[model samples]
Target: MSHKKALEAFYHKLRNLRGNTRFVGGSLILFSGDFRQTLLVIPRSTPTDELNPYLNSSVLWRHLHKLTLKTNMRVQQQRDASAGNFAKQLMDIGNEWIQIDESSNVSPCHQTSVRSLKA
Candidate 1:
């Protein structure tokens, strides 16, 4: 099916499931490089009789905001863990670069030649 059709079907399924209590505690997470750019594509076509759940001011949008707030709080509580992970990643990258630089054999003769060329 087409992209629009698939999204509509997904939203329809969600609407139907929304009334059912068995599917409680479900969540949807959307990540974008630029939220404004992503929002610009909402309701892809012109204003229609039907509303898209993905658009701003929709029920899902409100839920997303709530989720974002909760996530931010949890992240704040784990600031030390986040910093540790960031430092680990930085060290890994630095070690990889060091290995690469060491592996590339540049002889002393080559260094002397480069220095002489500068003179």
Candidate 2:
């Protein structure tokens, strides 16, 4: 994921170019990404350092419309029971619906491709 500063810089540049500082040159600029997935890569940095540069951390975040998608394409398109179950588990993990212990570890309830995705 790109840093929030980079996006802000682009916004400023757009303002200078179009003379419209309203928001991204008064043009709609769509930023799409799954925050549950990977985030800013700050080498040898702590969790706080990594989060500080995220788009969500920026002042501009509050201005953008947030949309949440609920569909799981794997479960819908494949029409397989196992795939659906796996997808649900993955979603649960992402949404923090499944609780983790104080030890900061989660037990696998069933087989899933999350580990494979790490690879």
Candidate 3:
């Protein structure tokens, strides 16, 4: 899934829990994501649309409190297309990059070639 879509999913989760939360004076909100996407989740009285924050990094960093997970996970692969093959690729870049791969046969969920990224 795209990072924006994933953020929307998280937003939906929080919207689901709205009734369960009781606000005495302040609210507790936790958002964790890539620097760009996390900024979209900031709670404001006037709600922002889903696509706005991703387009503006300034808005994102302005609202960001912390950033983590700087390292990339890397792995090697032989030519294969079984479930294990999917797992190997997924481990490297996660499902998001799968969507971005340009090959016709290789999809985010199923890929069929060696993909390497520099550390």
TM-score of each: 0.24, 0.74, 0.22
**Model 1 accuracy (lDDT, Cα):** 0.46
Relative to the unseen true structure, what is the C-alpha lDDT of residue 48 in candidate 1, on a scale of 0 to 100? Answer: 45
Number of the top TM-score candidate: 2
Residue pairs clashing, model 1: none
Ranking by lDDT: 2, 3, 1
- The global C-alpha lDDT for each of the candidates, from Candidate 1 onward, is 0.46, 0.83, 0.46
lDDT of 1 by residue, 4-88 (tens): 3444455667657776432222535453332223223445476442334334534434444332221334445677887666655
Report the Cα RMSD per candidate: 16.0, 8.7, 16.0
Ranking by TM-score: 2, 1, 3
Q: After superposition, how far is residue 73 of candidate 3 from its true place, in Å?
A: 14
RMSD of model 3 against the true structure: 16.0
Q: Model 2: runs farther than 4 Å from truth?
A: 39-44, 100-119
lDDT digits (tens) for residues 63-115 of candidate 2: 88988888887579988999988988988987779976788778788985645
> Which of 2 and 3 is ahead in lDDT?
2
Q: What is candidate 2's CA lDDT for residue 90? A: 88
